[model samples]
Structure formats: C-alpha cells, structure tokens
Target: MTASREIRLAARPVGEPAPQHFELVETTVPEPEEGQIVVRNTWMSVDPYMRERMDDVESYLPPFQLGAPMDGSAVGEVVASRSAGVPVGATVVHFLGWREYAVMDAAAATVVDTALAPAEAYLGALGTTGLTAYAALTEVAPVRQGDVVLVSAAAGAVGSIAGQLARKLGATRVIGSAGGPLKARKLVEEFGYDAAIDYRAGSLAAQLAEAAPDGVDVYVDHVGGDHLVAAIDALRHGGRIALVGAISTYNATSPVPGPSNLFSLAAKDANLRGMLINSYFHLFPEWIGKAAGWLADGSLHTELTVAEGIAQAPAAFLDMMRGGNVGKMLVRL
Candidate 1:
C-alpha cells in the first residue's frame, strides 16, 4: 500500500463553495489487483460542471458523496500495472481526479500519447474541454458561411475554443461576452472574435445588438440567465442555440426561471438544444484528429491557468467559478 492525499466532500455547499465544505484526507491506497492499474496524477481538471455535482440534488451526473473523493478528469503516468492493456510508464487519462494517485480497473483509464501534445492537453483542448466545444458547434448549433455567431463566457476554456471554431467553420462574424475588459479584449485580439461584449458593463441585449447589427444566426450559450434571453431576442430567423451550460445559475438556491422570451423561438423559428459531452464520446476520435491538425497548423491556440499542487484544487475550483481564469483552469500536481 501507498499513502495518497485526496480531497473529499465534507458537506454539501450552500451557495458558492467554501474551503470548509471540503476535507483533505490522507489515506493508504491499495496496490492494483488483477485488471487494475495505479496512476500518479500529473494534471487534473476543475470545471463548471463540478459545481453542480457538489450539490446533493439530482442532475446529469450524480452528486459527490460526502467523505469520498470527488472525481473529474485526470491525466497521469502509470507507475504500476497488473493489466496487459496498460503497462508501467504509460500516460493515461481517467475520471479519478481530486487526488494525487488513482488505482482503478485498466479499462477505466485511456492510455494517451504524451508526444501528441502533452498529458495536460488531453485534459484541455484535446480532451473533454475541446470535445465539448467541437460537438456543441458541429452538432448542436452548427455555424454556416456568412452566419453571425455569439458565444457567452467567451474567454473560458470551452468558450475560447468555441469562438475560434465558429470562425474556422465559416461564421462571417463572431461575438463574445465575458465579465471584464481584459478578458473581452483577449476574446477579440486572441480568440478571433470580431467583438467582445463586457456583460458587466451594461445591458447584454444592448451590447449584443451593437456587436451584431444584422442579428446572430448561432448562439453558443455558457451563461444562461440573462444571456439566454438576450440571445433569444437578438436571434434572426432560423437561429440555432447550443445550450452547453448555465454557470449563472449553477449555485442558485432557488429555482431559476428560463428565458422569458422563449416564445421568440417559435416566433423566429429558432432552435435551442442542450449539450452533454458524455453523450457524444463517439465523436471523440474525429474531433481529436481535427483538433490535433488545428493545433499543429497554428489554427488552434490554447491557454491554460494552472494552479499548482493538489492542495490548491479547492481554490482553483473557486477561482474558476468566480471567472478568475481566462482559459482552462487546471490543477498541476
């Protein structure tokens, strides 16, 4: 057995999670048995979806059980293996994060090539973060030539990539909405957005109108409250919305109402579709190849905000929830 440090849910968070809600525990991790492998994690991902899981309420994913390690995406090097499929020293990706080490069935881990990009890339652009953007744009709300697209949380891990993908996919104009000026500027200058609206500055609807005078054909929603309503109001005929997240309401203690102008969907013949990345894993191979090419050809640029050490995972998660990170928020161990 080996000693491992892990973060467990001590209590269900009330609003935004606090340090008291998490407990850091050090325990012995048993050796991998038959068909099992042990990984020493190098990088782990903390995303907005995890915030929902912190609550005990039912959602797409089950709530994190109290006194158990919370899991997400983690990439690491296998130090010991009893399975023939995965050998020692192989880099692997699995859903066993919030810890320094993970021991699980070999089938639970997917061996990844570090040479392709890096172990961290698998948790970011080439992994779940990238796949989320790709599937949402291509399948949920595809961009067409001459179409105007708007992405909320534009400077975030998924939104950053989503904006760039829309542009590459033939959107004539792309607009983004972020919280601050720096992130807004980064969206326009770095992420290829034609306009970046500071949702903190004024009315989102007015800003979106000014950004796209002709109205938008595609709306990639990450912040759902007022942003969804704004997109609905600004959508032209046959506009499509990819509802990926509702970060604004993720920590709500009360029921948050949907867009009041949802009637506009019928009025404008628009479509709104929710996206869950787990349901689209089949498209991962295709997306990985395309995203790899984009990365190699300088067409895709990735940014990361790394929080060092396993102990900092809670702080990193909180910072991400507060929109403190511009791109992907990762905990590097």
Candidate 2:
C-alpha cells in the first residue's frame, strides 16, 4: 500500500492559526475508485480565506472539520487513473489539501498544461488568484478609460493582478496601497500602478490623498478597517467600491467596524458592492483569456513566495497573514 503524509486540523484557532493547530499524519493511499484519480501533489496555495474556515462560525463556505485535512487550491500530477477522461501523467488543479497525495474524482480536477507555466503557478497567478482579480475588475467593478482606480493590499497576489488589470482596462490613473516601501515601489515600478502609497507610514487618509488627488473612481478593497475608511474618504462622486477579502480584520476576535464615513456613499452617490468570485464562475473563461494574453505578452507579472515543503504550510500561512510575504504564498511538496 502506498502511504501519504497529510496535515490535519488539530484544533480550531481563536486568532491566527499556530503550529499547534495542525498535526501531521501518515495514512494509506486508497486506490482510485470508479471515477477517481490519484494525484501526487506538487504545490498547495495558502490564502487569507483559509483563516475564516479555521473558525466554527457560519460563513459562505463550511468550517474545516477537526482532525480532517484542510483543503485549498492545489496542483498535482496524476500518478494513477481509473477515470476515463483523466489520463495518467496529467497535471491537474483541484481543491486538494496539504497532503503529499490525494485521490479525488476526475471531474473535480481541472487538467493544466505544465508546458505553459510552472506547476505551482496553477495554484496561484494562473489559477484562483488570477480568476478572482479578473472577475472583480471586469464583472464586479468595471473601470472605464480616464477613471481613477485604487487598490488595497496592492502587493498581494490578487491585488497586484487587480491593479494591472485596471490599468489594462484603460484606467487613467491606477493607485495602490501596500504595507511597506518595497511593495509600494513594486506597485508603481513593476506592476504599472501610476502611484503607490505606504499605508504603514502614517495616516492612510493622508497617503491616499497624495496618491489619488483627484479622488478614486473605483476602489478595490482587499484590507478592511482603516483602509476601508480611507477608501471611502478618497472616493469620487459616483464611485464604485468592490469589497474583496478583508485581510486586516481577519485575525481580530471581535467584529470590525465598518467605515464611519459610509454615509459618503449616499452623499457621493457611490456604490459599495461585496464580491464573491465564485458567484461569477460563468464569466471565468472570458477573464482567463484576457489574463492569459497579458501574461504571455509580458503585460502582467506574477510574484510568488514559495515554501519548500508541506510541513511548512502552517508557517507559510501565518507569515502571509502577518505581511511577511511579498505576493502569493504557496507550499511546494
């Protein structure tokens, strides 16, 4: 019997997940059933959304069960196949956990071309992160030419892509807010953001004003709390706000307050809409086509912070949440 090493949820975390929250175990790899394929995982994605699942609270998605493997986006090579459509040796992406191997139905996996990009890219830039950014910019909040666009968490996987996509969509000014100076520089110099603000320096409101003096027409909010307040204050008349992930308040035990200036929405006639990327799956193919073209032509660049093994997944996740990572955080197994 083939054996696989997996990471299971050892405890429900109250705040940020610690090493104690996970336990490693060895288990026998089950044979592929009627329509299943066994894959040897190569990489796994670590995202902010996983923090929501660690708690028992009700959410858009179910909580992670204790003692069970934690699931996220992953890329793997099919080592054995019992399904007709899936072939052995194919590399596929799936909702597989932090395991060395997984056996899942063929239908649940999306076959990817390893020749196009690295296997790990399927779990990041070329995968969910890319799709999420594309959907937010194109479907959730469409920015027109001459519009001023602002993005929070500007150095992150999704936010970086969103900023580039906004520019590509013909936004006259693309501004970004990041935690540090390096990320701020990256946003402007590398990602084509017209201006970048270092939110950690001082007041976000002041930084926002300097970065987007004309007022932002579209705000892609990735961090909530103070950033949300700043975005509200910086919005132009009839602006649009796309609420993506609220990374700032994710670890807070109490409910984070909404912007005090939410009344600005009424005063400015602005629109604030929450976006859940899964809701726009029907438009994914179109978004992918656009992003793929940009990626091929060097119009879009991807930044990844990769951990070397599955055992480092928890540490990598905690680092990402703490802003230790520059871009997408992933684990290579």
Candidate 3:
C-alpha cells in the first residue's frame, strides 16, 4: 500500500477557524481502478470561499464532512493511470486536494498543458482564480469603455487580476480597497489601480467617495457588509456590480445584516448581480487564450504566497482568512 497523508475535518469551527478544526493524518492510497488515475499532488489552493464550506449550511457547495478529507482545487502529476486518455506522466488539475496524493476517476481531472503555464499556476492565475476575474468583468459586469471601476480586496487572487484586467478592458480609472496601508499601496503601485483606499483607516464610505468622486461605474465586491454598502452608495446611474465573494461575512456565527443602502441600486437603476465561477467554466478556453498571451507580454501580473508541505495547509488557510497573504495563497506539496 502506498502511504499518504491527508487532512480531515476534526471539528467544525463556530467562528473563525483555528488549527484545532483540522487534523493531519497518515493514510494510504489504493491502486487506481479502471478509468482512474493516481496523482501526486504538487500544489493546492486555499481560498476565501472555503470558509463558508466549512460550515454546516446548504450553500452553493456542500459543507465539509467531519472526519472526512477536505477537498479543493489542486494540480498534480499522474503517477499511475488505468485510463489511456490520461497518460501516467500527464499533469492534471482536479478538485481533490488537502492531501499528498489523490486517486480519482480520469474524467474528474482535466489535463493541463504545462508548456502554456506552470502546473501550480492552474490553481491561481491560470485556473479558477483568474477565470473568476475575467468572467466578473467581461460577463457578470462587462466594464464599458471609460468606466470607473472599483474592486474590493484588491490585493487578493481575484482582485489583483481584476484590477489589471479592468484597465485592459478600457476602464478610464480604477479604484481598489484593501485592509492595510501596505496592501493599499501595492494596489496603486503594482496592480494598476489609479487610486487605493485603506479600509482599515476607517470611514469606508468617505474613503470610497474620495477615491471615485464622480461615482463607480462598475464594482467587483469581494468583501460584503460595509464594502457592499459603500459601493452601493457610490454607484453611478445605471452602474453594474458583481457579487463575487463575501469574505467579510463568511465566519459569522449569527446571521449577518444586509447592506443598508441597497435601495440605492433601484434609485440609480443599477444592477447588482451575483456570480459563481463554476457557472462560467465553459469560457475557460476563451479566457486562457487571452490571459496566456497577456502574461507572456507582461500585460498581466500575478503573485503567490506559498506554504510548504501538506501539514502547513491548515495554517495557510487560517492565515489567508486573516488577510496574511498578498495574492493567491498556495500550499506546495
């Protein structure tokens, strides 16, 4: 038997997740069955959406089962394969993560061309994270030429790309909101944002108004609550807002309140739309075609905050939740 290590949910967290909520256990990966492949995971992703999944709620994704291995996006090289379609040396991206090895049906894994980008990139910039940014601006909100755009959590995986992509999509001005002064500075200096607002500095509504005095034509909301309310108030007439994520309210033990100024959307004839990347998976090819070229030409830039080994995955996830990461938070196994 091939010895492997996997992380299981030891307990559900009532509030913010702690290390006790996870358990690293040694296990075994069995031989692949017909139409299956065994992969040694090289990289895995830790995202904000995962916090919601840890709860026992009926959300977009199923809650993590106690005593069961937690799973998410991962990139790995196939070590053994019973399916001819996926060769033994193929590099694939799949949903089984939080472990050193994964055994799953070949159909569940998509063969990724490492020549176009690194395998680990598929978990961040070239994978769902990047796709979320592209789909948010192009389909969900569709940034118009000369439009003023605002992205919350601008230093994050999706926001970092979204800001740069907004400029490429013809936005005349781009504003970003981050938790700290350092991240706020990076938003303007590195991520191509014309202005940056440090939410930690207080008075979010005032800061947003100062950044986009004319009004925000399009907004990508990653942090819900106050950020959503602020965006609603500063929205231009007939503006568009894409509800991509709500990292702010993910760990609440009680029901979180809605944005107080949500009625402004109706007054301004604005559109507030919620988006899920899974719904736009069909556009992956179109995004990669453009994004890959942008990366090669240095038009698009991405950063990674990496944690080494499977044992560090839980701590990495907790740190990511607390905004300890600059970009995509990854665990290198």
Candidate 4:
C-alpha cells in the first residue's frame, strides 16, 4: 500500500483557526477503481473560503467534517489510472487537496496542458481565481469605459487579478486596497493600478475618498464589513458593486451588522449584487483564452507565496487567513 499524509480538521474553530485545529495524518492511499485515478499531488491551494468550511454551519459549501481529510483545489500527476481517458503520467486538477496524494473518479479530475502554464497556475490565475475576477467585473458589476474602479483585498489572489481586468474592461482609473504599504505600492508599480489604498494605515472611507475624488463608478469588494460600507459611501450615480467575499466577517464571533449606507445605494441608483463563482462556470473557456494570452505577454502579472511540504499546509493556511501572502498561497507537496 502507498503511504500518504493528509491534513484533517481536528476541531471546529469558534473564531480564528490555529495549528491545533488541524492534524496531519499518515495513511495508505486507496487504489483506483474502474473509473478512478490516483494522483501524486504536486501543488495545493490555501484560500480564505476554506476557513468558512471549518465552521459547521449552513452555507454555499458544506462544512468540513471533523477528523476527516480536508479538500480544496490541487494539481498533480496521475501515477495510477484505471480509466482509459486519463492515462498514467498525465497531470490533472482535482479538489482532493490537503494531502500528498488523492484518489478520485476520473470525471472529477480535469486534464490541463502544462505547456501553456505551470501546474500551480491551474490553482490560481488560469483557474477559478481568474474566473472570479472575470465574472464579477463582467456579469456582476460590468465595468464601463471611463469608469473609476475600486477593489478591496487588492493584494489577494482574486483582487490582484481584478485590478488589471478592470482596466482592460475599459475602466480609465483603477484603485486597489491592500493591508500594508508594500503591497499598496505594488498595486501601482506591479499590477497597473492607478491608485492604492493602505486599508491598514488609517480610515478606509477617507482613503477611498482621496483615491477616487469624483466618487467610484464600480466597486469589486473582496473584504466585506467595513470595505462594503466604505464602497457604498463613495458610490457615484448608477454605480455598480460586486460582493465577491467577506474575509472581514469570516471569523466574527458575533453577528456582523449590515452596511449602514445601503440606503445610499438606492438613492444614487447604484446596484449591489453578490456573486458565487460556481454560477459562472460558462465563462471558463472565454477567460482562459484571454487570460492565457495576457499572462504570456506580461499584461497579467501574478505572484505566489508557497509553503513547502504537506506539514506546512496548516501553517500556510493560517498565515493566508491573516493576510501574510501577497498573492496566491499554495503548499508544495
């Protein structure tokens, strides 16, 4: 039997998850069935949404069961395959992450070309991360020509890609919000953002006002709580806002309050809509076609904060939750 190590939820977290909440275990890898494949995982993703799954609550995604292996996006090479379509030596993307190996049905694993980009890219830019930015800007809050765009969590995986996409979609001015001064400066120097807001430095509303003096025409919100309220306060007439995530409230022990300035959106004829990326699966092909080209030509810039080995997966996740990563956070197994 092939031995593998995987991370399991040791306990359901009440507020913030720590190393004690996760336990790494060594176990035998299951053999592939008739239509299943065994993949030796190379790279795994650590995302903010996974933290929500740790809580045993009703949400878009089911809660992670206690004492079982946790799963998310992972890319690996097929070492054993019982399916004809997925042969041995093929690399595929699957959702059986947090482990050194994964055994799943061939249908669940997607075959991607590594020649276009590296395997880890499938976990970030060329995968759901890029799609989230694309769908939000197009389907949810559609950026318009000459519009002023503001993106919160601007140094994160999704928010990092969002700034450039807004400009490409015809937004003349782009503003980004990140936690630190270094990341805030990178938003302009690296990601092509016109203005950067250091959300950690001071008041968000005041900084947002200074960034977009004419008022924001579109807002791609990744950090909810205060960021949502600030965006609403800075909204222009007919402004559009896409609620992608609420990292701010994920670990809240008490019930978080709603935006105080929601009525202002109605007064300004603005639109505020929430988006879940699974609903936008149809845009994958379109996004890959454009994003792949942009990445090759240096238009779409991406960075990675990788933690080596399965043992560090839990620590990597904890750091990412606290905004330690500048871009996509991944674990190399």
Candidate 5:
C-alpha cells in the first residue's frame, strides 16, 4: 500500500474560497488493476476554473463532491505499473491532481515527451493553456493582417499566450488588460502587446479607446462583465469577440448578469462566439507542433508561479483567485 496525501473539498464555498474550504487528508493506495498505473505527482495545476467546480451548479463539467479528492491537470512519473506499455519511470500527464500520488487507467494517462519541454509545461503553455489560446485566436476570432486585438486577463496562463499568438497570427496590434501596473507592463515587455491596460486603475472603456483609437478588430475576453461591455463598445464594424472565460464573476454569490450592451453586437455588425476547449481538442496536434517550434526558437516564453509542497495547494489556489499570480500557478510536490 502507498500512503498518499490529497486535498479534498471540505465545504462548498459561498464566495471566494478560503483555506477552510479545503482539507488535507492521508489515504493508502492499493495496487492498480491490470490496465492501471500509479503516478507520483511532481507538479499540479491550480486554475480559476476550479472555483466554479466548487459550486453545486450545472455547467459544462460536473461539480466536485464534498470530502472527496479534487482533480485537475498533473504531471508525474509512473512509480508502479500493471501495464507493459506504461512501464515504471515513464513520465505521464493525467487529470488526477491535488494529490501526491494517483492511480490512473493506462488510457487516461498521456505519456508526454519531456525532451521537448519540462514536465510542468504540460499544465501550462505547452498544454491546455497553449491549446486554448491557439484555438481561440485561429478559429474563434481569426485574426487577419492589420487587425487590432484586445485581450482581457492578459497576464494569466491563457491570456499570456493568446496575446502573443494573436500577433503571430497576423494582428497589426495587440492590447491586453491586467489588474496591476506590473502585470500590465509584463504584457507589453514580455508577451509582445502593443499596449497594456491596468484594469484596476480606472475606466476600461476610456483606456481601451485610448489604446486603440481606430477601434479594436478582435476581442479575446477572459474577464467578462465590464470587460465584455467595454470590448463591445470599442469594437469596430465586422469585429469578432471570443468569449473564453469570466474570471471576474467566478466567485460571485448571486447570479451575475452579462454585458448589458449585447445589442451592440447587432448594431456594430460584430460577432461573439463562446469557447469550450474540450470541443477543440482535435486541433491539439497542429497547435503543439507549432507551439513547440516557437518555444524552441525563443519566439515563445512561459511564466509560472510555483507553490511548494502539496499542503500549500489551497493557499496557492486562493492567491491565484485574488490575482496574486502573474501567469500559471502550480503546486510542486
């Protein structure tokens, strides 16, 4: 038997999950079945989307059950295996995170090549984060040459990549939004954005207009609500908007209303499309190929906010929710 430490949902949060909402418990893991393997997780991801799963509400994915081990993206080395294909010592990526060790089916664990990038990259830019950015820019709001792009939550894992990808995909200029001046500066200095708006400073509408006087041709929305309204107000005729996330309302207790200026979609002859990454998994092969090359050639860069130890996962998650992290937040075991 293997003793594993795991984080469980102790209680459903009302708003802004605190450390009390989670509990760390120890459990013994039995040997895996004939087609399963035991992975000792080295790195795990803590994301904003996990907050929505804490609520007992209907959404694209099911909510986390109370007092049970919660899961997300994790990268680990297989310590024990019952299948010959996934032998011990193979590094794998799986959905069983928030725990130090996990027993996963062979089919569910993907063997990623560590030679291309570090193991943790699978959880950040080289993994779902990169895929979401690529699909959103290329498909959701295809950027043409000379297009002016705006991205909200522009310092996060997905937004960090989206801003750069937009430029590479042919946007003439890219503007990003972050909560602080430092992050806003990072968008311009590191990720290659034309301008970075400090959303916490003042009016997003006024700032966006100043950033792009001619009007934005594409908007990749991550922080919805006011950001959505602002993007709609700043969009040019025949503009496109990709509704990727709504981090601003993730912790709201009451039902949050969407942008009131939705009518502007018709008035400005613009298009708004929602994105669910699962629907675009088919594009991963192509995205990975291109992203990997870009990364090797120094055209792409990744940032991470690491939380040491499995016990600190809850704190790390809370910090990320409060916009304490500049990029991807990970718990290193």
Candidate 6:
C-alpha cells in the first residue's frame, strides 16, 4: 500500500498560524470504494480566507475541526477510479484540503482539462479566482461604460482579474491599489489597468485622487481597513462597493475594526454589498463562460506565485497575508 503525507491542524492559531499549529503526518492510502477515486495531489491553494478557518467562529462555512486535515481547493490527478465516469488519468479539481493523496467520491470532483491550462491553473485563475472576479464585477458590482473602477489588492488573484473585467465591461478607467511600487507598476503595465496606486506610499486619499480624478463608480475591495476607507472617500455618487475580502485584518488577533469612514457611504449614496463565492456556485458555469471568452480573446490575464513544495505551503500562506504575493498563491507538490 502506498503512503500519503497530510497536514492537519494541531491547534487553533491565535494570530498567524505557525509551524506548531500544523502537524505533518504520513498514513497508508485508503482503498477507493465504489463510485470513488483515489487522487494524487499536484497543486494546492493557500488563500487569505484560510486564516478565518483557524478560528472557531460561526462563519458562512464551518471552521476546521481540531486534528482534522485543513480543507481548501486543490488540483490533482486521478490515479485510480472505481467509477466509470471518472477516468484514471483525468485531472480534477476538488475541495480536498492539504494532502499528498486523497480518496473521494467521484461526484465531489470535477474533471478539468490539463490541455486548456496548467493543472495548477485549475486551482487558481481558471478556477475560483477567475469565477470570483467575474461574479463580483458582473453580478455584485455592475459597471457601465465610462465608469471609474477602483480595485484593492490590485495585483492579487481576484483583484487583478476584477480590474480587467471592469475594463472589459466598458469602464473608462480601471484604477488599482497594490501594496508596493513594483506591484503597482505591474498592475498598469502587465494587467492593463488605466492607472495604479501604491497604497504603501503617501496618503491613500491623495494617491486615489491622482489615479481617479473624476471619482470611483465601483470599488472591488479585497484588502479592507485603510484601503476600504480610502475607496469610500473616493467614491462618486451612487457608487457600488463589492466587499470581496479583508486580507489586511485576517491575521489580527484582536477584534478587527471596520472602515472608520463608513458614513461616507451614506453621504455618497453608495451601496456596499458583501459577496460569498460559495453562495453563488450555482451560477459558476455562466461566469466561467464569460471569463473563458475574455481569457481566450486575450482580454484577461492570469498571474500566479507558485511555491515549490507542500512543505512550503504554510510559509507561502503567511507570505500572502503579509503582502508578499503578486497573484494567486499556490504550492506545487
């Protein structure tokens, strides 16, 4: 029998998860039951939202049980399949956490074509990241022609795609805010943003004013706190704010504070809408179609920062939370 290595939550992390919070253990691979497949994980995603799972709080999704393998999106190759529908050599995407191998029901995994993109891309760009951007732009924060769109975490997986989607949707200006100057430059030069602001620089309000002279019509917020506050201050009348994530406050041990300038929303007559991607899973196919079209036509770009091995997954995750990643963060096992 083959042995597989897996990472499990050893304890609830108080702040950022350290090596002690996770324990790596090896176990014998289990036999695949009927209608199930045994997959060998090739890539795993490490996202900011995973930080929230470490806490024992009531969330849209259940928190990770102590001593259980931490769950997230992953792409793997089916090594053995007992079901007729799932072929042995097919690459698939599933919510199978962090493990070298896993045995799951065929129905729980979706077959993905490796020919379309790299296997890791299934866990990133072509997968949830792209879908999230498409949904948030088209459904959550709809933008019209000549609209000014501002995106936070601008060089990140969802933010980068969201800015591009806004531009494709006919936004006159696509402005983005990233943590560093390099990332800000990449946002303008590589991702096709009309203008990009470095939030790490001078006053956020001043930077935003220079980037978006008229006013922001739609704000795709990924990094909350000051970024959200700045976006609110720069919004035009009737602007829409898509609350995608709050990476800035994800690692805070204390109670995280909301945007201090929230009253600006009422003054601007803006709408702030919270978005949970899982709640809109039923509409994924539609969003995927539009995103695929943009990707195929060269209107959308997918970026990634891949860590070499699963051993580095935790560091990669911590790095992402600390603003060390340029795009989707993943571990290539």
lDDT of each: 0.93, 0.87, 0.94, 0.94, 0.92, 0.86
Model 4 lDDT, residue 304, Cα: 93
Off by over 4 Å in 2: none
Clashing residue pairs found in predicted model 5: none
Worst lDDT 10-window in candidate 2 = 284-293
List residue ranges in candidate 1 displaced over 4 A. Answer: none
TM-score of 3: 0.99
**What overall lDDT, based on C-alpha atoms, would model 3 receive against the true structure?**
0.94
Q: Total clashes, candidate 2? A: 0
Hey, what RMSD does candidate 4 come out at?
0.7
User: In terms of TM-score, which candidate is stronger, 2 or 5?
Assistant: 5
lDDT of 3 by residue, 70-181 (tens): 9999999999999999999999999999999999999999999999988988988799999999999999999999999999999999999999999999999999999999
For model 2, what is the C-alpha lDDT against the true structure? 0.87
Query: What is the per-residue lDDT of model 6 for residues 156-262, given as tens digits with 9 covering 90 to 100?
Result: 98887887888878998999989788998999998889888887788988989888878899999898898888888888999999999998788788998777889
Off by over 4 Å in 5: none
Give the poorly placed runs of model 4, Cα more than 4 Å off. none
Better of 4 and 6 by lDDT: 4
For model 6, how big is the CA root-mean-square deviation? 1.5
For candidate 1, write residues 1-333 as lDDT tens digits: 789999999999888899998888998889889999999999999999999999888988999999999999999999999999999999999999999999999999999987778789999899989999999889999888999999999999999999999988999899999999999999988988999999999988888888998899999999999999999999999999999999999889989998889997998999999988988999999999999888888889889999999999999999999999988999999
TM-score for model 5?
0.98
How high is the lDDT of residue 322 in model 1? 96
Clashing residue pairs found in predicted model 1: none
